[model samples]
Target chain A: MPEAPRTGELAPELSLPDLQGRATSIRDLRGRPVLVTFLRHAG
Target chain B: MKVRDRWDRWEEIGAAAVFVVFDDPDLIRRTMLTDLDVGALPFDVLVDRSRGTYTRWGLTRASWSTIWLDPNVYKTYARLLRSGARLRSAGTDVLQLGGDFVLGPDGRVVLSRPQQRDDRPPVGELLRAARGSVEGGG
Candidate 1:
């Protein structure tokens, strides 16, 4: 299993589509603090 | 995850929160968002249909016992029920463990946590961590 990135490590590049299908990437959010949460199943 | 008006506080603190889910976006929007009466979230909620993000974050399948047999999950459901929230039918991926992370302005992780059972930290606590990470510069 790939170990999660630890504190002080660069976050893995996360580029995905939003609900509207627009591509979004964590790399774009650099220079700003962000809280990323992975949710299981909403249904 | 009753964000509603509380997200303004997150924005005020100069921190953004993004929700990453490995599911169909429309299904998630209809069933979950509407049920919670939450509309037009101020933050980005990315869809990870391939589970690639989960994999990168080292989140894997959770054990059946860790979910169904966990008393805390039931207790949390009961509490939500008392608060008038309806129970969602079987989750799409009960085995897929979830997680939380705080990334600093420099794009470095300041905190990394994998969810266990029903133990995700409250939004308030998350905001504080995010704020601290930014202010402390990782």
Candidate 2:
């Protein structure tokens, strides 16, 4: 039931693994605009 | 089709595109490699095994009725069928909802849209919001 971050608000820090299994975080890409999409499943 | 089509635009803007999925990296990698032939995507695909990201983003599970009764779902299924894609077992959580978000350079959210059905917030809308965020120095 957590609420999504609203516009003009800081996005929640995200730490997840890439396809190659390397750990990646949203905070690391701070200098550029990012489009993040959440998918229901891989299929 | 949308993200791939606008790949160049995203590159021109120096914006990063990331897809977060509630499944294993291996599964996603296989799907992208086999199901899609759009070459390499100019974005990173991340794995959210714990669903923590979804929770923080307020994405919830869709009801059974919503999944089956939604016209968008049927349209998507038909489209996939026409494309030679067969319906397969749900490899992951079928009810898990998804969403799109645009984050500015300053790490602030500019657009947050939680999908209400199988289809929503067209790619054009997302791209426009992203472009606006960059132009407005969000």
Highest DockQ model number: 1
TM-score of chain B of each: 0.87, 0.87
Residue pairs with backbone atoms closer than 3 Å in model 1 (clashes): none
> Candidate 1's error at B4, in angstroms?
4.6
Model 1 misses residue B47 by how many Å? Answer: 0.7
- Global lDDT for candidate 1? 0.81
All candidates: TM-score: 0.91, 0.90
Model 1 off-target regions past 4 Å? B1-5, B35-39
- In terms of lDDT, the poorest run of 10 residues in model 2 chain A is A13-22
For residue B15, what is the lDDT in candidate 2?
87
